[model samples]
Target: MQQVRAVVAREKDAPVTVETITVPDPGPGEALVRVQACGVCHTDLHYRQGGINDDFPFLLGHEAAGVVEAVGDGVEGLAPGDFVVLNWRAVCGQCRACLRGQPWYCFATHNAAQPMTLADGTPLSPALGIGAFAEKTLVHAGQCTKVDPDASPAAVGLLGCGVMAGIGAALNTGRVGRGMNVAVIGCGGVGSAAVAGSRLAGASRVIAVDVDDRKLEWAKGLGATHTVNGAQTDAVEAIRELTGGFGADVVIEAVGRPETYRQAFYARDLAGTVVLVGVPTPDMSFPDIPLLDVFGRGGSLKSSWYGDCLPSRDFPLLVDLYRQGRLDLDAFVSERIALDDVEAAFDRMHRGDVLRSVVIL
Candidate 1:
């Protein structure tokens, strides 16, 4: 066993504390990672809030980049000293989704066979199965997706979750094409990444809609072709006006709220796709769009899971892009913080004041 410092949310609605966690040596099909950096995502805050579940004493960080410290029996293709981005979904190739060749939709993903626990031997529920806000963490061998070591760990770690989701929403789920007009609602970290993705995918017009002026400004830097102050104007009307009254070819709803979802619904051009990347609370209702419109709309309505990404396929490609300076991933990092600063980071995130506060170990 190894003792390491980690952020732990002991119970629902309680503050997280830095504590010593006992991480066991890698067992079969597992690897031990020394986390270099982890991004402070909203999902981590959700875990702390018990929004994900009632699971107590959760190990609460997932968006991570690390170096492999050790690989256990039967592990292959990875070794000590390898730089990697930790992924939550370690696909089971025999699962229905993987057998069907859509491993991105794998239904039976898993984590390490054994658990990392508190000093008292109480098992900790790792956030998204990747508890990365630590000096070290244990994960399934498949969870470590190797990336170029030259890339920035703090920036690339964001790709483990939020940024990847945004990019994948446009490239994979929405199928945004050249000359397509795209509008993304909620210009937070994920939404800004969507704007970047739209531009990368060759969308001629990428409109970012957000209430926060700061977020809109950040979106512009990430390749948004235009910006809309949704608080100042009707977002649907503004989007239509920008698109010659035809609406957008693809509308990404990155905020999981009924009102914003309705805005996305009406803001789409007929037959245009709608990609919902934001997570909604269970009490949130589906938008009350008319049934007739649902039947009349000729396009797809989809939910993006982890940006519908295949880590092995996408992580390295994105890292290379970042290294080439084609992708401005570093823009998403608002600041670099110590692991002990997680609580303060949550405050900034809740205020919608920053894109991401990364914990650098």
Candidate 2:
């Protein structure tokens, strides 16, 4: 075992503290990674708020890129010195989803069998099974998806979560196609990435909606052809106006609220898709839309789970696209900070002041 410094959250609504924790060597089917960069995502904030679970002293950080330090016995096709993005879902081949050839929806994923412990020997729970806000982390071998080393760690790390979800929501789940009209609600990192993804998928008109004008401007920079300030106007009507008064061909709801979802439901053209990529809290309840409206809306109402992405397939392809200049992953990273600044990053996130604040180790 090796001792390493990591940010740990001890209780709900409490601040995270930097402390030393023991990082054990990888066991069977696991690998130790030297973390290069990790992004501060909303999910991490949720975990700190005890929204995820009651696992105290939680080691919080996912959406990371790193170099493989060592491979445990029984691990194959990986070695030390490999550059990889850490993924939360390590598909278990025996799971029902995997057996059905949909490994992307693998019901049972794997994490490192051994635990990293606190100095007093208390076991620490890893956030998303990847406690990467540290110099080193251990994870299931399958969690490490190899990518080009030339790709910037901060940029590629975003692919491990929100960015990938947004892109895949458009390209994979929504099946956006050439000349399609796409409108994405919410102009945060995920929503902007969806707009970019729609453009990359050949969507002719990419409309972005947000309450903040600054975010709308940011969305346009990411390839949105039109921007709607939802705070100033009716989003559904604006989207309809932009798409010949019919509505967009596909509407992506990235805000994850009933209000935004209702707007998305009503803002799409007939027989159009509604992709719900935003996450909703447990307290939020569904709206009482008439069953007739559901029946009349002649298209799919889908929820995108991590954008239905298969990390092994999508991560490398996205990194390659980034390298080819077809995708601008770097544009998503607004700023970079050290590990100690994660709390401040969260503050910025709460204020909607930045797209993504990455932590460079």
Candidate 3:
């Protein structure tokens, strides 16, 4: 057993605190990772707010990169000292999705066989099955995807979640192609990445829509060709005007709100794709668009789960691109912080003061 200091949310709406927790040695098919960096994501806030569940004393933090420290029996293709990004989807090969060769949609994912607990033996529910806020964490061997060792851990760690989701939404779900027009609604981390992905896929114009001017500027740095302050203008109208009055070929909704979804719906050209990458509260429902409009659109309405990514295939590729300077992974990192600074970072995130505040260990 190993005792490590980690941030834990003990109750709903309570400020998170650093606690000493016990992590056990890796069991079969698992590996122990010494986390180098982890990014603060909205999902962690959701868990802390009791929006995810009533699971209290949650061990929070998931978007992470680390070095493998140990592996248990049956682990293969990974070793100590390997640089890796932790992924939530550790596909079970026997699942239906894997059988159909679509492991990205794996119905059964893997986590550490054992649990990390508080001093009183209360098991901590790891956010997204990867409680990486600590100095070290245990995870399924399959959850650690090897990436370029030379890449910056503070930057590449983001690929473990939001950044990957945005990029994947454009490349995989939206199928952005050369000369196409794309618009990303919401210029946060995921939305900015969507803009970058669209540009990388050769989109002629990438429009970013957001209420916050700062976030829009961040999107611009990530490759947005145009910007729309949705708070001041009709986003759908602006998107249409930017795309020669035909609307965008691909519209990514990253805010996960009904109003923004409606904008995305009306902001796409005929037969265009709409990819929803945001995480909405359970009480939120689909927008009240008429069924006739849905049918008349003549295009796909897709929900991008983790950007429809296969970590084993996408992580290394993205890391390489970052190394080549083709992808600006570093742009997403607005600040670097210590683990003890996470609470303040959350306030900054809530106020839209930063794109990402990465915790460096």
Winning model by lDDT: 3
What TM-score goes with each of the models?
Answer: 0.99, 0.99, 0.99
Model 2 error, position 153 (Å)? 0.4
- What are the lDDT scores of the predictions, listed in order? 0.94, 0.94, 0.95
**Stretches of candidate 3 exceeding 4 Å from the true structure:** none
Looking at model 1, report the run of 10 residues with the lowest lDDT sum. Answer: 294-303
Stretches off by above 4 angstroms in model 1 are none
Steric clash pairs (candidate 1)? none
Count the clashes in each prediction.
0, 0, 0
Model 1 per-residue lDDT at 300: 83
lDDT tens digits, residue span 171-204, model 3? 9889999999999999999999999999999999
Give lDDT for model 1.
0.94
Instruction: Give per-residue lDDT, candidate 1, residue 240.
Output: 99
In model 3, the worst 10-residue window by lDDT is 278-287
In model 2, the clashing pairs are none
